[model samples]
Target: METTQHRVVATGHADWAGTSTQYQYIGPDQNKHAERVSWKGHAEAVRRFITDLLKQKPPALTDLSHLAAVGHRVVHGGDYTTAIQITPDVRSRIEQLRTLAPLHNPPSLETLAAAEAELPNLPHIATFDTAFHSTLPPKAYTYPIPMKWTRDWGIRRFGFHGLSHAYCSNQATNMLDRPRDELRLVICHLGHGCSAAAVQGGRCLDTTMGFTPLDGLMMATRSGSIDPGILEYVQNNHGLSAEQVGHSLNHDSGLLGVSEISGDLRQLEEAANDGHELAQLAIGIYVHRIRQAIGALTVTLGGIDALIFTAGVGENSSGIRRLICSDLECLGLELDTEANTACQPDADIATKSSRGRILVIATREDLTMVREIQAIIDLSSQGPGGVPQVTVSKSNDKLPGISNS
Candidate 1:
């Protein structure tokens, strides 16, 4: 008899107050089966979804006990540098970070608590989105601020979408058939939450997101990077509260704010196609920031071996990809128009003669979480030497020999 591996993923909750839960099963038959549900109320919906899934008793998973581990995608880990089995301490730490990731952490906590209540026996692991970027060097992560703020307040860049970045990097490595250590990559993860990372030898050198997800490239609603002076100026001149400024930046800006329309790219694209000026401007700004970041990260990497695009807009929007990649002949990145249009996940859309390859990869953060959880479990079983470890191959002291120009 062949064995079956089952996994369940529950995500969403912050964007629009919804939860998307998925149950997947893979057996030796090579056929994979999955069921998904999108409903309102984050924790309650996840609890009910799981309970209802169990009641149906799918052939792949007959009972809740069959689950080996329950993995969660926690957006902010604060000081947590690695994925760990969730304990009381872990839960408490996650709660404490809620203020930092006010939109994300709370729902994740609620889901974790609900899952624990419903399936108490299984191990629950938190695979932080910030964990993968913990490899950032002091020079890359440090902020040019006061010593008190940097040391005492823990104020520094803690890159987000790390799980996606790691997954994309590994997938790109496989697709390129190159050794992990030999490659230098700049990955652009564009979605509701956008970020970019400069990866060399499977390790993160630097990333765009700083301190929080709102600091990176323009996102669906978030303002991305903006002048700190603007915050004070708005407060002093416009008589806005600090909280209100934060709300406006996080909820009112980005594509929505600029276009004065929907925050969603699809909607913006539709409107832009109809010659909506602000919509067109929104698309232009979004692409401009991404292109600028790619160039900056390329300089950070010394050179770029491969440029990978993943997540919602990066994977699906060929037009956006074209606009982003245009006028980059100097960097030796030439997108194959047809290839880009017909691109699938893990597909290479670069011209055969291009020096730097361009890849469109569909990010699998859930799978990354599952792998990290399994690794931690395996490490734990090998007798207690110390805490479990998640290791990435270290790079050399000197940066790779690639020209800045």
Candidate 2:
């Protein structure tokens, strides 16, 4: 079971024609290497990655034949119940769901097209970010909109950040050394985008995000949950088009909109400490919303036995963590101040007596995708009949924790 982990992420997907890609190779047996290279488009990014990977001394892929399949992380999988092999029809369906996730799905489709072109012989697998939230009951997923809209248009709460939530919840259980069925967990994934999920017995009961990614917690530039009337009002009175209104909420809002400074937390934190009033306000709103979501998710889990934080802000920002946990004692989380600031990830920051443990776990969405791909292959091998199985190579990159064999 050999594996190599590499990330090739594109920037400026808003204008896909001119994009820059940042790639990193973190194979266990190989020293970590990362570089930010400019690629004209998604296709170029894929070409550049494949070329560089093959050129590695102990090449991440000395031969394309040894690579079994390419697993993709699709952010929005409208009604997909599980991972699917990217056949022509499946690809078409994924494309159709683009309107549901205009910002995320378009880039994914571009990436998928590029990867398929480069690895024409290998199976391309898509493991969705929404599949994990399929366990959400009707009460949790139903939108209060008209029945025709939901029934005819397929509009419903299809939460995102499922990969992160799934990864973090599993890691939380491992850290607590508790059985999943016995533990109720609230997992917060805070990064450029943020969301919280409530899981019990390995099933997601509810999540902060709704039909789209922008419905839950306020993100770096996205206005989380805003009054629908406000959109109507602006268009009706201000002569703003729907596109303009949508653009403003999605791009100019959240911390950046409030602070009128920057969206990056590090920047906001510094300005806030320097007595920048708007920066302080932005930080305050961010923490308040997260804390509110945590409380709400805790209730969804019946009560939380553990609260897990993952992703950029959740894992590394101690200041944000302290602020969120300050008044959360009612929810049974007691953060150990010293441990909270000094601890590394996969470590608990809770006091011994706290009823609900506070865990900071680094998310491994890639490993999760690999596992999904492996499961699909393994299932297909069990007497056939499913998305056509791809040949499985016994080796590839080192995925530190997952057993690919």
Candidate 3:
């Protein structure tokens, strides 16, 4: 086996199963890269993801000892993760925050531990989804909750999807060739979960999601931005327990609850096609809330120069994009009817004639993790900020720290 040196293995949970994307840049033979293996996870999805990576293509090129570091997508870093790095102390702190982000942090910690136990000698880095929004203005992050709850419990709004938002906004700027400081934009990241952000001069001015992922616009299941009084009312009158209310709000509400149907957008769309009244109601509520958030972000940014649509729903669903953008003509946003209808994923789905640019950029947080890993590697080699470029090695199909079910 040819001994390969460095590579980036980026993993993500799209359908509740982890999939690793390997990127290796060999010097002269870099152009002759191999086809990527997107392994499917069946029983133990996380374990299967790793098991398949090694089986599909053994790491013939890189040695385990030379593999520098592994970078992870660590969501909800709270106040700890401002930048990206790999250290035992950071991992411990991220584990401590599992209570804050019940859905995201704990699983990420599991993946981290798995990686660590498997490759104890190699470094593992964690890049936060909440870090970029760390630049949030106080007015945007502070909630109207009691001071004690916020100060003691860390209960202020810590926006999610900062990694995607930052990547999309920066990519938008680069593509537009505009300086980051001058561009004021509103980015809508709609997926199974949804959030809208107001970015001014590359910093988060305001966002829709507060404190928890549950805050923000209506999602596939989440009830975004609900009145706190509703929970109390449900508990007192309806005789529902706190956990039941939480479950309903987190898993039963939104499109699923409204339509009384499937949580998947495709199902909801099909129901709407069949002229189901509740489906229309569910979609209507979803789009209406999205527009509402856009309107509010307009005030936050004064006036946005560009509008960005990203994530699963934002990048893939043109109908939702059309409905959301149609009403924003007053804000100098108009989608070209033909182009909007014809656009696809990973493409710049924007209108040509619109005064304010509207773009559909695919969010690549996995690639962002690769970059962060390389940066840390460089920092280790050439002191702080000395290296011009981050070095990434190619992995020859080394297995992840996952068990096969």
Best model number under TM-score:
2
lDDT of 2 by residue, 332-361 (tens): 889999999997988899999998899999
TM-score of every candidate = 0.85, 0.88, 0.82
Write the candidate numbers in order of decreasing TM-score.
2, 1, 3
Q: Looking at model 1, which ten-residue stretch has the lowest summed lDDT?
A: 396-405
Tens digit of per-residue lDDT, candidate 3, span 209-312: 87878899998888888888999999999999988988898779999999999777888988998999999999999999999999899888899789899988
Query: Candidate 2 local accuracy as lDDT?
Result: 0.76
lDDT against true structure, model 1 = 0.75
Clash pairs, model 1 backbone: none
Q: Which residue runs of candidate 3 sit more than 4 Å off their true CA positions?
A: 1-55, 58-61, 84-89, 345-350, 378-405
Q: Locate the minimum summed-lDDT window of 10 residues in model 2.
A: 394-403
Show the colliding residue pairs in model 3.
4-61, 4-62, 6-393, 6-394, 7-393, 7-394, 59-396, 157-211
lDDT of 1 at 404: 5
How high is the CA lDDT of each candidate model? 0.75, 0.76, 0.69
